[model samples]
Target: MPIPKVQKLFQKTFFGIFSMFGVIGFSTSVLCVYTVDTHLSAEYESNSRDIAKTIADSSVDILLNRDLATLQSLIDQFVEIQGISYIYITDETGTFLAHTFVPGLPEVIRQSDPSNTDTVERNLPGMGDFVEVGSPILAGVGGAVHVGMDTGLVALKIQRAIGQQIYLFSTVFIIGVFAAVWFVNLAAKPLGELLGYAVALAKDGAKAPPSDSLLRRNDEAGQLARLLLHCAGFTDADNKRGVAAPGEAR
Candidate 1:
């Protein structure tokens, strides 16, 4: 059976370059997104936990005195902080002492274990997503202070960061494509000539000697072309009769 046709060196080289750049760009984008998400999520959660503990610490004395009004004012001031969507305090009995929710407290907030000190993600109906952080008031003696950090805002920041990175990588990939095309074309020219010469020699006796330009090339392709010429039995006198390409010595 006749051998199946194979892609030329030009096509293979260009495709290989393209694939390399594509893989690198895609991997970088994924890594950047993951890094941005991890760092931002951690920082936001830390901020929420810190704020919750701070409010809880300050509210300890106020809560002991049964100063609900002052506790409400204190949390009201902190609720204005960025990324903090809501704030609430609960008694040891789990009854809501004060909350920033407009209509009512969320069931998820009530379900949280005040004694457990951990950050958790929860979605409150009509309230979107939140990262809930609770700090026990007076180590669970006084009511616990819980803060809700907006997950939507955190996600938005991550998306914005990832978008910028993708844009940068896309720009680099585009520039790389052009460079790859130029490099492949530059590298393929001499290979194409050598292939044609080899194929001609195989099909019939190579009557036409290699050009002086091929003989005078300073690169590896020039060496291969000269080797092919020598193997083809073309003497120095034969190529000496041909003219070199401009700016090259035979």
Candidate 2:
């Protein structure tokens, strides 16, 4: 079916607005999500660090005393903490002396010999999807405590927040678009009627309609209406003059 130009214009304008809003909203939402994710991650890391330190401090003495039974019980207590995925006590040689998940001994202990101490914070393979934090149990002692906390829960939380924000922003965007269209139509009503009068004059050469509320204003639309009226006068004058050529033997 053939569509009117006004309908087409309105549709194009609406879609343009929708696209612009979508891009802006998506970018903003992504930034907000990332900000929340980073903040939550930092908080989790800080709290987890304190817990790991407490566990290490309380267990280091027992381990040094060679109290195997007490150390085992301490490791059990550490594992009982919520969100803790794994715990391991390792010596300077990177040998896993004890672990919560694997009993006896672990074949491999994940460790990096980075020039920078901060490299320990980097994610590594075989560590599962968790934040692995390690600290020396005692000053100048070759022993270290490694703790891993599952970050899957934190990721899930951020995802939920982003989804909710998308829904909320989409609703607001749609409402804003509708309101804009309504205001445009309301403001254009007078211009539409003025255009109709001009069209009738063009088609039938009828007397021009009286200048109404539209002509009283000094806006672009009012200026256009005045120009149209002036042009109509010129057209009528030309018709009345009816100039004839001398060669026609008048």
Candidate 3:
């Protein structure tokens, strides 16, 4: 048998709801993460620039005097700050005066600009991800201070946010599915009742018709129910008319 109009409507509505939620949830999650990541990136750059400037201001006097102990201690203090991977200071000739690590200076330090600070992400062999910030000390005349900060924590927070979004979206999707099923059943109820009534009439013409509750509704389903009830009565009237016609002709 062909599918009923009510069933078709249910199918279409369910599909539309599911598809719409899927797209909206996915797009919202992606946009939220992207927005957060962008903001975090900007925060990282701003924070690094500020920290580097602070270090530069503090180290300029000691750097000019070539006080290795004070510079080392100063850089060491800043290194203890959370998320700081390493900090170093270099002289006007690009020679490192003090550093938290003994590694050779990166080639970029030679080209460092004092007027403008710079930050870049580096993926080292053992390090997952590190961002290096450079600031010129003494207005580029004294030297420069470079700081590297760990980014794993920021990434972890982003992941946590994404997880929360997933959980929230999943809960909403489940509720929506259940609601769709309920609404479909509610919408199809009148049609179901009409079908049952037609079946009853087919089996036994003497059976009483459906109640007027459905016919009283203002909805399309009520209209259809009213039409079906009218057809049933019309059919009975036609039968009686045929019988009376034969009797009248005789």
Off by over 4 Å in 1: 1-7, 64-66, 110-117, 196-208, 227-250
Q: Which candidate ranks first by lDDT, i.e. highest?
A: 1
Candidate 3: global Cα-lDDT? 0.71
Clashes of 2: 0
Off by over 4 Å in 2: 1-16, 65-83, 91-98, 102-128, 140-142, 206-250
lDDT of 1: 0.78
Which digits, one per residue and each the tens of the lDDT, describe model 3 over residues 32-106? 889878888678767777888998998777776878998888878878877777777777776667877546545
Better of 1 and 3 by lDDT: 1
Each prediction's TM-score versus the true structure: 0.77, 0.66, 0.75
The lDDT of model 2 is: 0.63
What would the per-residue lDDT of candidate 2 be over residues 1-250, giving only the tens digit for each residue?
Answer: 1111234546677788888998988898889789988998877777667766776688777877878677767778877777676667766565556678654333333444211112133343454477767666664274677776778767887888888888898899979988978976865665665666577667775374425565554565566655565555545443234312112211
Give the winner by TM-score.
1
Model 3 worst lDDT window (10 residues): 241-250
Tens digits of per-residue lDDT for model 1, 1-250: 1222234756777787778878987787788778888998889888888999999889888888898899899999999988999998888887889989988887777787756657778899899999889999878877688888898997898789878977887898788888877776677666667667777777786787555666667887677666666677766576556533333434
**Order the candidates by lDDT, highest first — what do you get?**
1, 3, 2
Per-model CA lDDT versus the true structure: 0.78, 0.63, 0.71
Q: Pick out the ten consecutive residues of candidate 2 with the lowest summed lDDT.
A: 113-122
